[model samples]
Target: MHDTIFDQLERDGFAVVEEFLRDAECEELVAAGLELTRHLPDAPPTVFSTTEPEQQQLKDKYFMESNDKISYFYEKDALDADGKLQLDPSISLNKVGHALHLLHPIFRCYTYSERVKALCRELRLLEPAVVQSMYIYKNPGIGGEVVPHQDISYLYTEPIPPIGFWIALQDATIQNGCLWIARGSHKSAVHRRMLRSPEDRNKCIYDRPAPVYPESSFTPVPVSKGTCILIHGNVVHRSAPNRSAASRPAYTFHVVERKGNNYSEDNWLQEGENAPFLNIYTTSQMQ
Candidate 1:
């Protein structure tokens, strides 16, 4: 068999590897996710839209730890005009995780699975560390648009950039806002990052003037529930807002270099100089 996925990644900057997870496993994950949403009222402080007023309450609740914790992002319809979060699992939830692998056992099983590690080895990631984990629920009609950007800008490391593993927990179709990527975009250098404002501390800044790309270049990627989309860090990609009647929930995590310890301390999510980024291979949960 040809090295299809890896070959496409090298040339096109992204690849869709089919059947990465079994259908039964996908169903299990979805059910587990639904269970977690029940605790939204007591969820740890979350990082979401700055436009909402509820951010202040979350800031007050978590105090200093608010900035770095498992956050919630609700669907637009889930909130009132005043932006207060409504108390219903069906309408009021969009995403329930940032560090899900660390917070829950089910997610950790998927994150540190041998299948993921072997994929990393195929990509020649020698000492990969799991840096971030997120479960995104692209709710029906209100799933927001993700603007065109590269992953390297958000959480960066010197010498090399991280790779993103996005697994579709539901059938991702064109109607439900499947991911879109600019072919060969990873060949370009990262232009900007959404970083915390050093001065204000509360706000984030997108280094400007923003780098622009042609709109006609993007191609939609639709996959089945168990499919896995492996994304290169420098790749310019985005997804549209879901207007369809169904939801597209995806489990996404990121991995970066660890052996050389080149992960940048200045990255907004880094807690401190000595803070440890969980090692994907040897983490206690993985064991």
Candidate 2:
């Protein structure tokens, strides 16, 4: 692991590594994402969507498919009556997303790569493993804005928090909805989480008030394709909607310590053998 990248993360709560992936690697990753479209109809039932009416409607149907494998969700109008996305995906879909890394070899390569394991070691995360993965299709015009929030707010873990590793498969710009982070916010003590209610389990609620950081502390981060952005668990961040004509596609995964974590049963998503986490590393070896 590069010291510069680790230093930046320690100082700013996040770090941006340019060209972490080569041009050819980026092309291959993008192609893998596009290839997922052809198998959308039969993919696992882990799909989710933004706040668009049409897209939100499909969430229930897809979510009920199968909890053991990968799934694909899209923007409201991306699918027709036959549950198929348009041939020209650029204009028809918002994203083909949710829990794909372990199920797909192409994505697993990056999620469990040696390069990533080294970074996890640098962070001093004990027994680090991937807990979640998603590919965002910030398509033009229809892509929705993600409100400011922290990763630990959703992926609740006690004593240790999850770190996000976001990869830019295509150029990410302010005009096309790149991430904006609250600089140094990770240093602030924000221990609460946004989790489902224990009584209903279906209801979403926060354990405590959300963190309040000064607006002036926020910084817009624009990165080119192949760039990797490392974000601390407590750092507050968000992204605007994609209004530009271009698309901002990205692959993101989160890592958390396996031992000493609560791994609450009430957390919204709980299914499969491993349920919510995937082993990315083993003692004396990286998976």
Candidate that scores best on TM-score: 1
Model 1 CA lDDT for position 60: 37
For model 1, residues 1-287, the per-residue Cα lDDT tens digits are: 77667688888888899999999999888887777677676543333442353434223334223234566666666666766665466545667656676666888899888898788888777788776677887778777677777888877777777889999999999999999999999997878875556785545455654566788999999999999999988899888888999989899988887776476544556543332566666765543
lDDT of 2 by residue, 109-193 (tens): 8777888877787777767877667777777776777767888776766677678999998899999999999998888776566
Task: Report the Cα RMSD per candidate.
Answer: 3.6, 4.2
**Residue range with the least summed lDDT across 10 consecutive positions in model 2:** 50-59
Kindly report the root-mean-square deviation of model 1 from the true structure over all alpha carbons: 3.6
Off by over 4 Å in 1: 42-68, 200-203, 271-275, 284-287
Each model's lDDT = 0.74, 0.71
Please, what's the RMSD in Å of model 2?
Answer: 4.2
Clashing pairs in 1: 46-71
